[model samples]
Target: MAVFKEIFSHCSDLVYRKIEIEGRQAYVIYLDGLIKTEDLQNHVIDEVLARKQVGQLSVEKVEEEIVTVSAVKDQSYLEDAANDILEGNAVLTIDGHNKGIVFSIPGYKTRGVSEPDSEAAIRGPREGFIESLRVNTSLVRRKIKTTNLKIESMKIGVQTQTNIGIAYIDGIVDKNVLKELKHRLDRIDIDGILETGYIEELIEDNSWSIFPQIQITERPDTAAANLLEGRVAIFVDGTPFVMILPSTFWQQFQASEDYYDRVYIAIFLRVLRLMFVAVALMLPAFYVAVTTYHQEMIPTNLLLSVAAARESIPFPAIVEAFIMELSFEALREAGVRLPKTIGQAVSILGALVIGTAAVEAGIVSAPMVIIVSLTGIASFTIPKFSLAIAIRLLRFPLMILASIFGLFGIVVGMVILLIHLCKLRSFGVPYFEPVAPLRFSELKDVFIRTPIWMQNSRPDDFVKENKKRQANDLKPSPNKNEG
Candidate 1:
C-alpha cells in the first residue's frame, strides 16, 4: 500500500479498497471512474469474500479460483501492476503475496458507433469507427473473418501510452511495406498522441508535401476494403479516423458508394469526379490567365460581356480572382467551424450576399464571381478531404503563376506539380502508381471503375504474392431455359 500510494501520489482518482479474504488482508486498487463499481463489488469483492477455502491466498490462487472476471492475469512487478491499473484494470494485492492479480473490467463511457460526418454514403454500411480501439478492430474483424487478417497491437506514446493497432492481411500484404511501416512506427518517440493526425504526421514518408501520403477514413468498411487491397490500416486510440497507408493519388477520388452502385454509374461518377478535379484545380487560374493575357481565346460576344462586366471594376483580373477565392475559402472554413445548422446557412447566405454585394458595388466582376463559385462547388465533389485540401493549397500558387506568365506560367506550374507528384512515395509505394509506371493492367480502375467481375487481380504494386483477388470469368448471363 505504501509503495502503491507513493507511485500514484497526488492522484485523487486512484482508489484503494481494503478487503478481508478468508482472514487474509488484501487491497483492490483501480481508478475510480475507469473501473465498474458494480462489477468490482460483485465479481471481485463478493467472490473473494464468499470463498471459504482453507488454502493459502496467493496471487495465482486468488486469480484462478476466486475471481469471477473472465479476463484475469497476475503481474509480478509493481510497475506492470500500476500500468494495468492505469489501463482501467483492477489490481489485487495481498499481504503475504509479492504479485498483484489484474482484472480487466474497464467501464469508461464512450460514444456509440455513429455514421461519420466526414464520409457519408447512400448505399454502404453506415457505421463508422468510434474512439474505442477494440470496437474499431471488431468492426474490421466482422468484415474480414479470415484468420490471415492480422491485427498487431503496440503502445506508442510515452506519456499517453496510447494503444495503436496495425491491421493487414498476412498473405496479401506486402512484406516490404509492412516492415517499413513497423520501422517508422517503432521509431516514433513522442510524449503523447492525442489523435491519428499526430501519428500521420510522424510516420508519413514526406512531411514537407501538402498531399496526404497516408489516407484517413472513419468508415470501417473503407478500412476493410483497403486491407483487402493489400494496404495497411492504423487505428489510434481516442480518435475515429483510422489511417490507411500506401495511398495512391487515384484512391482519393474513390468513394465507398462506387463499389455499391452499378458498373456504368460508378464509371461515370469516377470520370465526372476526375473532370471536376481538373476544374477545381485549374479553373480560377485559367480564368485569370485568359482574361488578363489571352483575350483572343474567348469568343467575341462572351469577351465583350466579360469586358463590359469588368469595365467599372478597378482591380485587375488576378486581383479580382484573389479577392473572391480568399473570401470563399474564409466562408467555407467558417462554415466548418460554426454550428452545423447555422454553419451551412451562414456559408450559403454569406456567399450569396457577399458576392452579390461585391458585384453590385463593382468591387469585383460577375465573371470572377461565377468562376470562384464554380471552383468551390467542384472542390466539394472530391471524396477525400485531404486531397481537396491539397487542391486548395495548390490553387493559390497556380493562380499566382498564371497572373505572372499567363498560360505559359500555368503550364510551368502544372509541369512542376506533376513532377513533384511523380517523385513522391507513400511508404515506399509510388504515390502516382499505374499512371506514372504505366501499368496497363491496373488502368481499369484509374480513370474508370470497371465491372467488379473484370477486376480479378489486386494492385501488383502493393501485393507481390497475392495478386489474384477473385476467380476469372464471373460475369453474369441469362439462362437459355429462362429466356
Candidate 2:
C-alpha cells in the first residue's frame, strides 16, 4: 500500500479501500470514477466479507473463491498492478501476500456506437466503431465470426501507453506485408500517440507524399471488407477511425455503399467518382491553360464570350484562378471549423455571394467562377476525405505549372505525378496497384466494380497466399422452365 501510494502520489483520483478477508487485513485499490462502485461493493467487498474461513487468506484462494468478478488477473509485481489500476482495473492486496489481484471492472464513460457522420451511407450497416479499442475489436469480430480472424494487440506510446490492435485473417494475410507492418510498428518509438494519424505518419512508406498511404474509415464494414481483402486494420484506443493498410489508389474512391447497391449502380457511381476525381484535379489547370495560351482549343462562340467576360477583368487567367481557388478553400475550411447548423449554409451562401460579387465587381470573370464552382463540387465526389485533401493540395501545383507552360505544363505535371505514384509503395504493396503495375485480373474492381459474383479472387498483390476469394461459376442463370 505504501509503494502504491508512492507510485500514485499526488493523484486525487486514486482510491484505496481497506477490507478484511477471513479476518486478515486487505486493501482494494482503484481509481475513482474509473470503476463501478456498485459492482465493487457487491462483487469484491461483499464476496470478501462473506468468506468465513478460519485461517489467513492466500491470493490464489481469494481470487478463485471470493471474487465474483468475471475477469480477474494475478500480478506479483507492484508495477503491473499499478499499470492495471491506471487502465481502470481494481487491484486487491493483502497484508502478507506478495501478489496482487487485478479485477477487470472498467466503467469509464464512452460515446455509444452510432452512425458515423463522415462516412454516412444509404445502403450499408449503420453501426460504426467507437473510441474504445475492445468495443471496436468486438464490432469487427461480430462481422467476421470465424476463428481465422485474428486481432493481435500491443501497447504503443511510452507515456500514454495507448493500446493498438493489428487485425487480419490468419490465412488470407500476406506474411511479408504483415511482417513489414509489424516491423514498422515495432520501430515506432514515440512518447505518445493521441490518434491513429500519429502512427500513420510514422509508419507510412513515404512521409513526404501528400497521398494517404493508409486508408482511414469510421465504418466497421469498410474495415472488415479491407481485412477480407488481406489488408490489415490498425485500431487505436481513443479514436473511432481505424487505419486500413496497404491502401491502393483505387480503394479511396470506393464507398461502403458501393458493395451494398446493385452491380450496375455501383459501376456507374464508381465511374462517376473517377471522372469527377479527374475533373477536380485538372479542371482549374485546364481552364487556365486554355484561356491563357491554348485559345484555339475553345470554340469561337465560347472563346468570344470568355473574352468579353474577361475584358472588364484586370487580372490574367492564372491570377484570377488563384484568387477564386484560395477563396473557395478558405470558405471550405471555415465551413468545416464552424458549427454544423451554419457551416453548410455558410459555405454555400458564401461561395454564391462571393462568386457573384467578384464577377460583378470584375475581380474575376464569369467563366472562371463557373470553372471554380464545378471544381469544388467535383472535389466533394471523392469518397475518402484524405484523398480529397491530396487532390486539393495538388490542385495549386498543377495550376502553377499550367500558368507557366500552358497545356504543356499541365501534361508535364501529370507525367511527374504519375511517376511519383508509380514509385510510391504502401507496406511493400504498390500504392497505384492494378493500373501502374497493370494487373488485369485485379482490374475488375479498380476502374469499375464488377458484380460481387464475378470478383472471385482477391487482389493478387496483397493476398498472394489466399488469392481465391470465392468459388468459380457464381454468376446467376435463369431457369429454363420458369416461363
Residue pairs whose backbone atoms clash in candidate 1: none
Per-residue CA lDDT of model 2 for 1-483, tens digit only, reads 899999999999998899865557889999999899899999988888777773536788778887789999899998888889988999988888788999988788999999998899999898999999999999999999999999998999999999999999999999998999999999999899999999999999999999999999999999999999999999999999999989988899999999999989999999999999999999999999999999999999999999999999999888999999999999999999999999999999999999999999999999998999899999999989999989998989999999999989999999999999999999988888989898888889988888889899888888887799888988889868955
Q: What lDDT does each candidate get?
A: 0.92, 0.91
TM-score versus the correct structure, for each prediction: 0.98, 0.97
In the predicted model 2, the residue pairs found to clash are: none
Off by over 4 Å in 2: 20-23, 52-56, 481-483
Winning model by TM-score? 1
- Model 2 residue 164 distance off true place after TM-score fit, in angstroms: 0.7
- Per-residue C-alpha lDDT of model 1 across residues 1-483, encoded as one tens digit per residue: 899999999999999999875677889999999978999999888888776663646677677777789999888999888999988999988888778889999899999999999999989998999999999999999999999999999999999999999999999999999999999999999999999989889888889999999998999999999999999999988999999989999999999999999989999999999999999999999999999899999999999999999999999988999899999999999999999979999999999999999999999999899999999999999999999989988999999999999999999999999999999999888999999988999999999999999999999889999899998979988877854
